[model samples]
Target: MLHIFCPHCGELRSEEEFHASGQAHIARPLDPAACSDEEWGTYMFYRDNPRGIHHELWDHVAGCRQYFNVTRNTVTYEILETYKIGEKPQVTADGKQTNAPSTVKGQGEKV
Candidate 1:
């Protein structure tokens, strides 16, 4: 079982206590009212399902009932680190120090 650290609870808890929402740090359209149908559709439906290091939004459903960000390695199922929603991640696939979300090239292959 994956042990996840809840930034709100400040304790490491089992994965059962949390729920993975989806990819994190997605920017909402500046003007939803002005967005084209295709643009809105893409924004609402499309998400980065990367194979390497991925930033995710998780909720401590059975614990603090708060949401946070998780930087994880999808290939190894490793929990790299967890932070509050507004905070940036410390690790990336590029090996450069950055908080921005890392981008991978392929679909199902490991980076």
Candidate 2:
């Protein structure tokens, strides 16, 4: 069983207690009407399935019932860090750690 940390609850809990929602930091289209059908469809349907490091949205269903972001390694199934919805992650996809928050928008951002 995997242990997942819920940033809201600040506790390590069982994987069964949580649910993986999807990819993190998805930005909603500013104007749905303005977007082409393909654009809207892409926004609603497309998601990344990377082989290595990934940022995902997860929910603490059995505990806090809040959404959080998780930086994990897909190959090893190792969770690098758990962060709150709006907080920046310490680890990046390139395997670098930084003390400062990332300026790149839509990366691990909440929809």
Best by TM-score: 2
- Candidate 1 stretches greater than 4 Å from native: 99-111
TM values, all candidates: 0.84, 0.87
The TM-score, computed over Cα atoms with residue i paired to residue i, of candidate 1 is 0.84
| Tens digits of lDDT, candidate 2, 24-110 | 999999899999999999999999999988999999889989998989888888887888878788888887897796532222212
Estimate every model's Cα lDDT from 0 to 1: 0.77, 0.81
Q: How does model 2 fare in lDDT?
A: 0.81
Query: Which 10 residues in a row give candidate 1 its minimum summed lDDT?
Result: 102-111
Provide C-alpha RMSD values for all models, in order.
7.0, 6.1
- Cα-lDDT of candidate 1: 0.77
